[model samples]
Target: MGLVVPFEDKNPDKGASIESLVSLVSADMERVNAMILSRTGSDVTMIPEVANHLISSGGKRLRPMLTLAMANLAGYHGDGHVKLAASVEFMHTATLLHDDVVDESDMRRGRIAARIRWGNQASVLVGDFLLGQAFKMMVEVGSLRALDILSSAAAVIAEGEVMQLAAAKNTETNEDEYLAVIRGKTAELFAAACEVGPVIAGRPKAEQAACRSYGMNLGIAFQLIDDALDYGGTSANLGKNVGDDFREGKITLPVVLSFRRGNDDERAFWRRALEENEASDSDLETAIAIMHRHRALEHTIERARHYGAIARDALELFPKSAIKDAMLETVDFCIARAH
Candidate 1:
């Protein structure tokens, strides 16, 4: 349960390209930090440690930045971007808090996961607090439509989580079921982040729809790449152990693919793992071999590339701002992470 992400130079194609996006989003994130920190000055002393653990854990803050970038590209000019951006971050953080508990994981980007440090109860309570904070910030945005999109996304994310719990260790889970889980867990919020800019900035319906589609596809691509990485990536490079999903009996792409490729004996092994008890490392190793034989990892990567291309194409509607360029580069950046 206790493993930390490696601290080293991963260098996911680090040039000077994303500096502008980072620069633009950092102020809003700082504002959020201040808002979060002020509670420490109030009576909630424990709030500081839990909140600080998340903040200092060194996440990319990608979701919130996407919201802000979409706002910029869509010609937004107000504090609503800040509020919505913070809202996106809080929602993302809440998911992480919950995810750690669900996975029984004790490490995130080289730090003890919150659930490990403070216990599952603390993690769940903190997650609920952040969810409330996210909604409160959304209300502060003063846009009911924005609120609707985010709330819907949050609901879908929760549903996806439950679906995964049900799907895990179930050999019957197919590509579509797996895709549904990915869409709910990842794409829905991404769509909201991308869609909010157009909504707040008063973009046309078509434009908003385009942004939503673009984000949805991009999020799927990102997760597919993440799934691919789990099979082929080094634990040191990935910030978590390779094949950890298999170890935990997660119904991931590779595992599903391996099951499909398995013969009668192989199917029997998987059935034992799912129906009997947890799988052993040898079971995991053999499963990886079967998946490799069936090229599941490769298939997932190809799909990721397809979605990355789609995400880039969605940007074609824009007339090309620096923000747009950065956004396009980000799509490329996401795809490149797996390479």
Candidate 2:
């Protein structure tokens, strides 16, 4: 997770409302720094450095922004949104820390990751510290509803990590299984981000539910498109060298689609590459060729569009406002990556 928003459309105007709302989210991040720093104190030089390293690194911070924007759209004017939003960011950062250790990723946002820079031990403990901090912040917010939202999201995220481990190899990772993992790993956080805002704002239950659904769909679409890009997009456009999934013997959207469309021999090639952990250049070329032949990229794009639309529809329950417009822009940004 480099701060680079590879999935966003080149069009600046796509999700103007969400972007505008995100401006406030950015300001709130500063507040987050103050909160974290005061808690860490002078003894923790490495804590501050690692925290800054991860926070300052380029990131979309999309989840926290959703928190702020939904709060605004739902007519919540309190300052607590800032604290809650920061808590959301902290939770996300903790996840990134854990994900890196699990994935063994060396780079994020084109820089050596925290785990890489400070060592895995530092990364793991710091991640735990942040998770504890995030909960503390949530408790300060004093909203059981907010706690419920984040706690549920955390549980779902853990389920996703385990699900990925279980589903890592073998061709059984169908669209449904893929969707389930996406929901658990990515969409749950997105939903948590948006839901916290409305819950804190004391919004109507229906509206809050819609925003959660909207974020979930948006997250799903975003992750699916990312999986597609791993097979097709350039490293410059997609960021973080592609093919890590294939290297790790993980099956993603394009691979699944390609195998579905491949002939017996072609399918056998995938079986050997994925199941046996052996893939040659010819195998890579064949997989790429197969994805292209069956238009898997296009298929993935269409799926992303479907989710973007659902995200937009989630905003329909809200009255027209600058915030709503920004939310819509974010939806477009999510789908326009491939467009």
Q: What TM-score goes with each of the models? A: 0.90, 0.90
Per-candidate RMSD vs. true structure? 3.8, 3.6
Q: What are the per-residue Cα lDDT tens digits for candidate 2 across 1-339? A: 121223323334242334565665566667655775565443678887887788777777777778877787788877777777777888888888888888787766657788988989888888888878888878988899899889888889989988987888777578888788889988899998888888888888998899898889989988887787767665555546666677677777777788788788888888898888888645665666777778776677777878888888988988888778777878777766553
CA lDDT for candidate 1? 0.79
Candidate 1: the clashing residue pairs are 5-110
Clash counts for all predictions: 1, 10
The weakest ten consecutive residues by lDDT in model 2 span: 1-10
Clashes of 2: 10
> Candidate 2 clashing pairs?
2-109, 3-58, 3-59, 14-329, 15-329, 15-330, 17-325, 17-326, 18-326, 18-327
lDDT of each: 0.79, 0.77
